[model samples]
Structures are given as C-alpha cells and as structure tokens.
Target: MSGPGTAAALWSALGSLPLAHLVPTGLGPWGDGMARLMLQPLDLLLLVALVLLAVQNGRSWSDRLALVLPLSWLVGGLGGLLVGRELHLALLCAALVTAVGVLAALEPALRLGKRFLRGGTAALSLLFGLVAGSSLAGHGGALQALLGEAVAIAVVTALLLMALDPPHPRWLALGLRLIGSWIAASGLLMLGWLSRQPL
Candidate 1:
C-alpha cells in the first residue's frame, strides 16, 4: 500500500481498538461506581493498625474510639465531596500509617501511657477519616461511593478486630509489631515518591 493509505489504515485500526473494554464500567453486580468504593491496601493496613491500637490498651474507650475512626472518615469524605475540594488523602494517610506503625512497633519495648495513647488514637482516627474522605471527591456517584466506602471500611475493620482480639501470644504480638514497622516503611517510601512528583 502507498504510505498515505498505510497511515490511514493504521489510524483506523487504532481507532477500532476496544478502548472501552480497558476502562472500568463500574457496573459490577455490586452497583454502578462501586469499584471506587473498594478497599485499597493502604486502607486495610490503616484499619489493621487502628484495630491493633484499639486492642492495645484493652480499655473500653479505645475500642469505642476505634469505631469512631470510620465515622470520621465518612464525614470527611462526604464533606470533601460536597465542597468539591481535592484533598491529599494519600499523603495524609501515608503519614498516619507511618506514625501509627512506628508506635505499634515500639509498643513492645517502650510502653505508652493509656491516657496518652487513647488521646493520640482519637486524634489520628478523626484525621484519617477526614483526609481519607476528602480524597474520594473524584469517584463516581459521590454519595453512593462515599456510603459504600464507609461501609466497606467499617466491615473490614470490624473483622480485623474480631479476628485479632488481643491477649495475643508473644509471637503474634511481635508479628504485629513487625507488620507495623513494615507499614511505616511503606508509608515513608510513598511519601518520598509523592514528594518528587509535579504538584
């Protein structure tokens, strides 16, 4: 074929590519736009840390405060959506993960006071919720996505808490601490990478 004809054919082939198939329709059995509500690795890690922190002190308030975390997140997320503001949730979450993970890792060696720990947990919970919520602004069907995300977060957190209820064996506790350290490390890495990106 002549050069121009070959170019035309190539353009047509490219145009015919099933680009729609590569994009998420977000129409799974769950619901339209539900995919954005799915829990991410960072979300799970944060929830795990929250649960561990809640059970760390074995106090009623700690458990109750842990429950508040998801509510706070939902409020923040919805608020962000309403205001149409973009929040740097990933950066905030990464920071929180690192801080919480470090504390968890150190819990074995350095004992934190109950009052101080509870206060910190409460503060962090609210912040996490707000930041995480704000970050959901771009998701489809804002209201539905926010509710679904909140529910999914709550369910996952509850399950983690139930499964890892403490009075954990020494080995298990150590394992959790190690996990915390790993989370912190991951957060640090993410933060570094984000820092280098064009704003």
Candidate 2:
C-alpha cells in the first residue's frame, strides 16, 4: 500500500470526485448554467433574503447588490473551479442562509446600516459562488456554467431590486418580512434533511 500503489489510489480518488450536474435546458452549457440556479435554488433564496435586507436598509444598498453580488459570486466561483472539488458545505451553507434569513426578517427592527448590508451581500455572494463553482468544477463547460449563473444572478438581482425599491408601503414591507421568514424556514428544513443523511 506504499509508494506508487498509494499514489495511484489517491489520484484515482481525487479524479473520481463527484461533479455537479447541470439540468439540461436544450441550450447547451450556458443555458444549463442559467437553469441550474432555478433548479437548485439555495443560492436564489440567499439572494432574495439579501435583497430584502437591502431594501429595508436603503436604496443605496439595493443598488449595490446589483453590482457587488454577481461580481463577487463570479470571482468566488472561479476560485472554486480552480480548486476542482465539490465543497461539502451544504449544512454550513444552510445554516448561513438561515441566519441571514433571520436577519432579513428582523431587518426593520434591527435597522442595519448601509455598510453592513453591502459587506454582508458581498461576503454571502462570494461564499455561495465558491460552493457552486466547486460543485461544477469537474463538469464539462464549467466556465460557461459559471458565466451563465452569474448573468442570471445579475438579471435577477436587478429585477428584484427594481421591483422592491425603497419607500415600501406597509403591505410590501410586511411581505418582505414574510418572504424572509419563508427563506429561513426553507433553510432549516434543508439543514435537517442534510443532517439526517448517513455520513
């Protein structure tokens, strides 16, 4: 088990690491990447929570999400691809999303500042991107997938921010909090499900 045998075994193990599959969209790699976000939606949930948090804080934060979020995600995804391994962070990520969701749900009461929102958005986006990139690392057209996801993120973030602009009415404000609560609950469910799996 020493020398070349061990080396070969180790190499084989690394080579066989599971690659994340893209849901086929009949649109090649790029389309598959775009479809991945909707099909696998933890990232979307986080994005929604962040947007809600931003809207609660100020318009400036919302605007920054459109720029900072996707860019940070892309950068982190690229780094993950370079690493070429799927991250086993589902549980941790679920916890993080849950925490963020709670923050969003309580945003009005907490009244977080603009700087906090900006930093939080960037950090979360990057971390999620890294996980996503790692998942896609060994797949064919990984770069295309990353780009597609990034574009989708940008488009979605912009549309959401536009639709949920500041000066929210009482009803819309309540709606945001409700959505945040749902995101948190979803994360908790995911955490429970993942935790139950046999390691």
Best by TM-score: 2
What's the lDDT of the predicted structure labeled candidate 2? 0.85
Model 1 worst lDDT run, 10 consecutive residues: 15-24
The residue pairs that clash in candidate 1, if any, are 73-129, 77-133
Q: What would you estimate as the lDDT of candidate 1?
A: 0.63
Report how far residue 18 has shifted in candidate 1, in Å. Answer: 19
> What RMSD does each model have against the real structure?
11.1, 7.5
lDDT of 2 by residue, 73-144 (tens): 999999999888888888888999999999988988998878777777888888999999998887767888
**Shift in Å, residue 113, candidate 2:** 2.0
lDDT, each prediction = 0.63, 0.85
**What would the TM-scores of all predictions be?**
0.72, 0.87
Clashing pairs in 2: none
The TM-score of candidate 1 is 0.72
